[model samples]
Target: MEEIEETPEEHLAKQHRKEKKDMQAKIQSMKNAIPKNDKKRRKQMTEEIAKIEADLNNKHEEELSQLKSSTDTKVEEVLNGVETMKMEGGKEAEAEAAEEEEEEEEEEEATQPRVTKAQKRRDKKATQEKERESRIAEAEVLNLQGVRHQEGLKLAQKLATKQLQIKEISSDGHCMYRAIEDQLAQRTKPEITMSMKELRSRTAEFMRGHADDFLPFLTNSNTGDMYTTDEFEKYCSDVEHTAAWGGQLELRALTQVLLLPMEVIQADSPPIKIGEEFDSEPVTLIYMRHAYGLGEHYNSVEQLKDPANAEDS
Candidate 1:
């Protein structure tokens, strides 16, 4: 028995199907490469893939329709030369085909996913809010852990009161500056709030002017050598303008800027003091702890009223 040869139309359809499948697979691979937590990138890739898929579908449909129309025209011409009855039958077949095509187009339109720009914006906002909430919850958990550890400290210089409130600061690389700003605002008259930018500028200037004091401690952790002059200049510039993560070095500069000792209280440890002692009455207390693997964070600590004082009130 001889195998039947494939028609030109069948071959064309098979080629289009393979092209469509390959394109779909490529799109899927691109989607898979995007990180799940990166909603913005995921949304962008999704939109791009949707456009590509739409274009492919439209081009495939147009090509197939043109091929079918050419075939129909050839059939009509053959029928006209053969018989009027066959020609009339061909017209009925064409009408049925048109109806079926219309139904298929309507089904495609109904099944196509529809998402408006407004809807997309809302979804993006919701995703951002969810991520923000998750971060806040994680920070709160870390804060509680730090508080528990602080409570268990065996130091004689413990917090005046057993009860303390912790105020979390934003950990956007400027946590140290923001934390210092919060402590200053609470400890000063008229409640001064220093912007992170201003704090950065002041800290940079102080470090640059008093390089002798800070340069010794500014050695590269990897190299274990003192920072070169160029490196120190770059460090000063980063402290001044960039959102560089602040550490003990910047904290020392901050002490000089504020002209007061910046005492850091940690869980189960003596207060790590910075800068020269001042005769000031109020001392800024910062709760220091590692937060969610994001380096060390400083949260302002507000001492609760003494039980005796509360009873008198």
Candidate 2:
């Protein structure tokens, strides 16, 4: 069968419909997978599915609106091209082709059933990019300032020369581990990358086995005494099983666990290099004291595509 060539607008619109259908079908499948006797689970899933559907509808409407705008723009462009064709000795083929495409677009708009696999990948990437931008904008709205803000600016200036930007990690007491995880995911291959739980576990295990290295520094604030064996055990348990805020000791342990050097960049201080004995390239993380109103937070650094145009600079 001969493949039909669609105008850009028609092509994009068709892709939009397929994405919507795929999402709806996925939700339906999820709904079906929930057992009928599981009333509580069914209710939760139904609510979540409804919310997803609402969001999807809004997104689809916005895209369709954009397509409508693009359609108007394309019509204007085609008219301009047709006028040019008339001026250039009346090129009948070019004008007729444009006319047919416009007619075909109208006829086929409601019948678009499928989109290519490559288009799905492109759509997914576009969605992720938009989500990233949305996160950045949200952080901007709740701006940080004063000491932390100044430090962030200084760090930004430093990173500008290196074509890097701070990718903010969530401030849920696990920022340090999360920042390291993010850096590892980007810097290392999949097999070498560690998840939050794995990183936490390794940090705890390393600290537990090498108590003398870390225990000396962990004095009780109330008693002014070194941690007892049980106290230390509890601390390590929290480090591994709970969202205990990761600190210098965890960073030190992670360097050994992953067998990679860790570089910590900070404002008002020099870069702190851990695991210097290792020969591998360091996974870098930035320490933010007050950015995003999250005190003592950690963020990862990523290189910008347009390195020449650093926005924070």
Candidate 3:
């Protein structure tokens, strides 16, 4: 039998159907390529597929509308029946395509390397343990200031007789205030304990009120130039509101505000006392020294009974 050549309209319809089938295949491939665990990519692929499917539906409707408008009554009835069958076929094909895609995904997942829940838990635990060990090593190194680790241990032993224990404070530029707060909490009645915030406000107020007494000493350490009025006011503001690092000048101000003697103890140096005129009795001893290039850290000292003496007694 001789093959009949298709009309231009029939050829166009054939081309559209082929193009739509190719688009569907591409959509299926894209869906399969995306990993099930990749939610972002999957969402993107879903949107793209939806757009392509909408285009295909629009094309189909346009072709049907053209065929109905151009054809006679009998031909239109025939085209309508064909359209119904095409719709049914399209639905069945879509259902089959969906099933195939799901099966492909399952097979791909089964072949991929899997991490068990138990293995994941073990990995997390190991990571935490390593972090903990690293922190402990850093803390140990921090204890040895300028001396070797062994020498530091010996110094600590020697100071043990004096019953000195260094209590570390946060180096958040408010170390002095925190250290003072800690000491005050220890010595004063519970109701009278001063918070760091309160201490900062009080110190700023005292320094501003007694500007004449402190201004001379508050000169720039390097330039030896006295602070201008504006500079002094900004300094007072920083001390009151900002987390400005405290220095000896601030310490002097604090001594006047608290009216308590403050002593600083250093290795191989005599104790330095401030506010001695205000009070004969010493309130607290703060340890000051460079800590592994961490500048200076001030820690309050707590005296305890000598372990050896306690054992002997």
Candidate 4:
């Protein structure tokens, strides 16, 4: 029995059919053996089948290329049918391919040598960098909180200083202010209080220059007929009603007596004798008496009796 010569088209078709059948069988076998979680093994098997199919197709292409043109339509039909099948099964194929690739990669990695100390060092540095960044972020948050706390402290100090100023200006004694300062110290120390000593020295200097004005309010025993600053304030405002005279105290006459110009005084006018002026002058010179003694007060008015009195007044 002699071997019969098959046409090129028939040969190519036969080879294509054989490969397609083999691919289907391999696919079925893989589907049956594969576990849902054994994706790695499944991928490897699918890849092997695909390689085989590729080789078969390459062979068919070579054979078809050498054949006459008459079988073009038949070859195209078969190729188109294969393409359609691939399109329909593309998602499944991709999934299987990915799983297989992962399995192969993992196997390869397993076989590879362990990482060196240098590689571990690099990984450690990367981890350390990440940890450092996390710490820096945490530090930034803490710093923001600290800033807010500092700002609050500053505001509190400012308020405390203002309160202290008011207290110093209004308090009756130094002991009272000291008590208040000590109480404030038990809580957070106020920044403004730190400068209180300087503030006090400045206030004392100012008070010294204006001591005469304030002396009237001092201890009556030492002052001897002088009014205190508080008394003076009340007297000036006309709030003090305990005086000998009643009704609105006319101070304009006293101001005129004190401010009278030396040149303006008519020399011919009756000389304002000491007892005569006090007896006749309607205005009460309380501040003058409060500032100077009764005798000095009389001398002041007597000096002012003439134009030379301007210098004395």
Best candidate, TM-score: 2
Which lDDT tens digits does candidate 3 get at residues 150-220? Answer: 43344355456667666668655577789888888777343346888998899899899988877887654
Estimate the overall C-alpha local distance difference test score of candidate 2. Answer: 0.78
Sort every candidate by TM-score, greatest first: 2, 3, 1, 4
> How accurate locally is residue 25 in candidate 2, as Cα lDDT from 0 to 100?
59
* TM-scores, each model vs. reference: 0.47, 0.53, 0.51, 0.19
Per-residue lDDT tens digits for candidate 4, residues 39-79, read 46657767876887788778877877767565777789899
What is the C-alpha local distance difference test score of candidate 3? Answer: 0.69
The list of candidate 1 runs beyond 4 A from truth reads 1-163, 188-193, 282-287, 303-313
What lDDT tens digits, residue by residue, belong to model 1 across residues 233-274? Answer: 888998788767677788877766676777776665677877
Best-to-worst lDDT order: 2, 3, 1, 4
C-alpha lDDT values of all predictions: 0.68, 0.78, 0.69, 0.41
Residue 97 lDDT in model 3?
82
Tens digits of lDDT, candidate 2, 1-313: 2224457776667667766776765675455344343357678888988898899888978888888998899899999987887788567876797899999998898687678899878877776676558657765665554665578789988887778888988766677888888887896454387889888889999999999999998866557799899878888998888766677888998888988899988887899999999988788899876554223668899986677667634
CA-RMSD of model 4: 42.0
TM-score of 2: 0.53
Best by lDDT: 2
Candidate 1 RMSD to the correct structure = 17.5
